[model samples]
Target: MRCRYPPGMPFYAYILLCNDGSYYVGHTDDLDFRLGQHQAGALGGYTAKRLPVKLVWSESFPTRDEAFAAERRIKGWSRAKKEALIAGDWELVSRLARNRQGA
Candidate 1:
């Protein structure tokens, strides 16, 4: 079932800095509620044990599928790519993107 937030807001692709200095990425329609669940350990998964996570970055999408797709793509990215994305270093991300194409 789809998340029921407003009528036509957007889904959020979010990244969190875990307490262990790692990162977690996910997508949800309600950013605040989802982040709260992660922080409260209510999700009972990776982020749950990695409590005290802080919201580091987020991107909005027109649909939940788009947000989830982006989250999945980012989840497979290298540390450098993730860092670059977190830092809003579009140039670095673009470089990494080009490198992935072996160009």
Candidate 2:
């Protein structure tokens, strides 16, 4: 069975601040459920072992593809870039990306 999102559903690109001071990036249409899963360790894997995860950042998109693309992009970013993003510092993120380029 295929489950389709309702009309006007919003998808999200989210970053979690793990207990060990690392970030986890992911996309979901249902943010609350996904967060709950991570918090309870039901999701398993990276966040499960880290435990005590907190919702650090998130951006909403009208479509799942946009949210997914954002997630993938963030996943490739360096810690500095991710921190810049979490701080909502677009200038810093661009600077970091450029500095890391061609290296």
Best by lDDT: 2
Instruction: Give the clash count for each candidate.
Output: 0, 0
Candidate 1, 1-103: lDDT as tens digits = 8666565789999899999999999999889999999999999989989889999999999988899999999999988899999999999999999999897
Q: Could you tell me how far off, in angstroms, the CA of residue 55 lies in candidate 1 after the best superposition?
A: 0.5
Model 1 lowest lDDT segment of ten: 1-10
- Expressed as tens digits, the lDDT of each residue in 1-103 for candidate 2 is 6548886899999999999999999999999999999999998999999999999999999999999999999999999999999999999998998898963
Candidate 1 wrong stretches, greater than 4 Å: 1-7
lDDT of every model, 2 decimals: 0.92, 0.95
Q: Among these predicted structures, which one has the highest TM-score?
A: 2
